[model samples]
Target: MFKIKHVLLLSFTIIALTIAGCKSQFEKIRLSNDVAKKYQEAMKLYNKKNYSKAIILFEDLSQKYRGRAEAEDLNYYYALTLYKLKDYTTARYQFKSFADTYPTSKYAEECRYLGAYCYYLESPKSSLDQTNTKAAIDALQLFINFYPKSERVADASKYIAALRLKLETKAFDNAKLYYDLGGFEVSNYKSAVIALKNAQIDFPDIKYAEEMDLLIVRSQYNYAKNSIEIRQEDRYNEAITYADEFMESYPQSKMLDQAKALKADSESGIEHAKRMIAEFQKNQEKYKAMLAKEAKADSTNTTIKTPIK
Candidate 1:
C-alpha cells in the first residue's frame, strides 16, 4: 500500500510539472516582442483548438497589428476564437467591429452573419425578458435584407421565424396573465382583450391565433358582464362581434361550439344590459320629477302674505 501511494504521488507530480512547463512555454511565446512569431503561434494554437491560450495571444496581436495589412486577419481570428470559447457577448461585439471596420474584407459577410447568430444564441426563453430576442430578430432580418442571395439567408430567415415565435409566445403568456387576473380585478378582462387583439395585429401569422381569438371573446364577455350598466351594452356588443369573427374565421375549430355559445350569451347579455340601462334612466327621470313636484309645493306654501304688509 505504501509503495502504491508513492507511485501515485510521483505520477501526479510529473503530470503537474509537465502542465506547468507547457504553460511556461506558451507564456514565453505570448510575452515575446516578435510580432510575426506571436501571430504564427496564435494561429497554430487556434488551429489546434487551444482557444484559451490563443485568445490571449490574439488580443495582444490585435493591438500590435492594428493599422497594418495583417490586422484584418488577426481581428477576424480573434473574434472567431472568442466565439469558439463560448464567449458570445464579446465575440458578437468583436464580430460586428470586424465587419464595420473591414467592409471590403472577404470575411465581412461571414462576420456579420456570425454577429447576428451570436445574438440569436443569447436569446433567452419566452418567459424571460425578450430584449435579446427582439434584437436577434432585427439583426437576422437585416442580414437577410443585406444578403438576399447569400446561402446564409435561409438560415437567417429560419432564425428570424424562431425568434418571432418566441415573441408570440411571450405575448400569449402576457395576455393570459391578464385574463387570469381578471377575477381579481374585472378591468384586467378589458386589458386581456386589448392585449390579445394587439398580439393578432402584430403577428398576423401567430400560431396561437385561434386561441387568442377565443380568449378575446371570453375576455370581452367577462368584462361586459362585470362592468357598470352604462358600459355593459357596448362591451357586450363588441364581444358578440369578436365571437362572430372567430366562428367565421375558424368554422372547423374544435372550439366552434364554445365560441357559438359565447356569441349567444353575449347577445343575451346585451339585451339584458340594455334593459337595465333603460330601467335606470326611467328611475332617474322619476326621481327628477318627484323633486320638481316637492319644490313647487314648497314654493306655494312659502308665498309672502301681502295683506299683512
Candidate 2:
C-alpha cells in the first residue's frame, strides 16, 4: 500500500507541474514583444483547434503585423479565428474587411462568401424581425454576381432562396393578421384586401398564393357587406370583380365553392341596393308633386278671396 501511494503522489505532482508549465509558457508568450513568435504560436494553436486561445493571440498579432507584407495573411487568419470561435458578427466584419483589402488574394473569394454566410447564420426565426435575413439574401446575391464561377455559388443561391422564403412567410403572416383582425374598430377587412394584394405583388410565387387569393375575395365580400347602403353597390361590385379574378387564377382551388358563393351574394346585394335607390327616387318625385299641388290650391283660394280690382 505504501508503494502504491508513493507512485500515485509522484503522478499527481507530475500532472500539476505539466499544467503549471503550460500556463507559464502561455503567459510568457502572451507578454512577449516577439511578433513573429506570437504569429507562429497562434497558427499552431489554430491548427490544434484550440480556438479560444488562438483567437486572442491572432487578435494581438493582427495589430502588430498591420501595414507589413504579412498584413494580408495575418488579417485572413484573424478573421478565420473569429469564425472558428463562432463570433459570427465580428467574423463577418473582419472577413469583409479582409476581402476588400486583399481583393486579389487567393483567399478573397472565400472571405467574401464567409462574410455573407455569417449574415445567414445570424438570421432570426420566422416570427422575429427579418432584417438579418434580408441582409443575407442581398449579400449572397452580390457574392454570386461577383463570383459566378465560384464553387460556393451553388450554396449561395440555396441560402438566398431560403432567406427569400422567410421574407415571403413574414409578409404572408402580416397580411393574414390583417385578415384576422377584420371588422375591428377600423375597417380591417379593407385593410386585409390591400395587404393581401400587396403581398401577392411582392411575392408572386408565394406558396400561399391560392390561400391569399381566397382571403382577398372573402375580405372584399365582408367589406362590401358591412358598408353603408350608399357605398354598398360599388363595393359589392368590387367584390364580384375580385371573385372573378380569383376563379380565373385558381380554377381548381379548394376554396372555389366559397369564392363562387361570395360572388353570388355580392351580386344579390348589388341588385338589392339598386332597387332601394330606385324606390327612394320614386318617393322623392311623389313628394315634389304633392308640394306643387298644395301651392296651386293656395294661389286659387287667394285669387278667389281678393276683390275684383
Candidate 3:
C-alpha cells in the first residue's frame, strides 16, 4: 500500500509540472513586448503545423507589427493560417485583403488565386442554389484577366469551365421541369418552350442542346393540339413550321421520326379544318335557294286566287 501510494504521488507531480510548464511558456509569449521574439515564435508554431496556436499569436501581432519590414510576411502567414484551418470564408477575405494591400509583393499573385479558390471550395452541390458557384466563376475569371500570363491561368480557366457547366445544368433542369409540368393546372407547354429557348440562347454549347430542341418541337405540338377549333389551324401551322425547322437542323437526329409525325398531324389538321368550313358554307347556300323557291310559289298562288275573285 505504501509503495503504491508513493508511485501515485510521483505521477501526479509530473502531470502538474508538465501543465505548469506549458502555461508558463504561453504566458511568457503572450506578455512579452519583444516583437522579434514574438514573430520568431509565431513562425515556429506555423512551421510545426501548430496552426491554431500560430493564429492566436499572428492575430495579436498583426496590428502591432503594421508598417514594420516584417508586416508583409506576417500578413501572408496569417491569411495562410486561416486557409490551412479551412476557415474558408474568413480566409478568402484575408487573402483578398493581403493581395490588395500588397499588390507588388511576391505573394500577391498566389494570394489572389487562393482567394478565388476559396470560393470554389465553398460552392454548394448542384441541387442547391448556385450563387456561390457564380461568384467563384466571376472571381476566377477576374483573376485570369488580371494575370493573363500567370502560371495559374490554366487552372483558373479549367475551374471557370466547370462552374459554367454547373450553371448550364441548373438551367437545363429547370426548363425540363416546366416541360414536365405541362397539362397540369395550366398549359405549361408554352412556358416550356420559352424556357428552353432561353436556355439554348444562354448556353449555346450546352450538352443538352439536342434534347432541348427536340423538347421545343414537342411542346409546340402539344400547345397547338390543345387550342380551340377556330384557333387550331393557325396554331397547328406554327407547329408544322417548328417541326420543319427541327428537321432541317438535325436531319440525322434520333427524334427525327417523331418530329416528322408531328408535322404530318398538323398538316392533316389544317386540311380537315378547311374541308369542314367549305361543307358548312355549301349547306347554307342550298338552304337559302330552297327558301327563295318557296316564297315565289306562295306569291303565284295568291295572285291566281285574287284574279278569280
The numbered model that scores best in TM-score is 1
Reference-based TM-score of each model:
0.85, 0.84, 0.80
lDDT of 3 by residue, 29-77 (tens): 9779987898899899999999998998999999899999889999999
Candidates 1 and 3, the one with greater TM-score: 1
Give the number of the best model, judged by lDDT: 1
TM-score of candidate 1 to 2 decimals? 0.85
Per-residue lDDT value at 184 in model 1: 100
Give the alpha-carbon lDDT of every model.
0.94, 0.91, 0.89
TM-score of 3: 0.80
What are the per-residue Cα lDDT tens digits for candidate 2 across 100-162?
A: 999999999999999999999999988899999999998899899999999899999999988
| Alpha-carbon lDDT of model 2 | 0.91
Which digits, one per residue and each the tens of the lDDT, describe model 1 over residues 1-309? Answer: 999999999999999999999999988998899999999999999999999999999999999998999999999999999999999999999999999999989999999999999999999999999999999888888878878999999899999989999999999999999999999999999999989989889999999999999999999999999998888888989999999999999999999999999989988988888898899999999999999999999999999987865
Worst 10 residues of 2 by lDDT: 300-309
Alpha-carbon lDDT of model 1: 0.94
Clashing pairs in 3: none
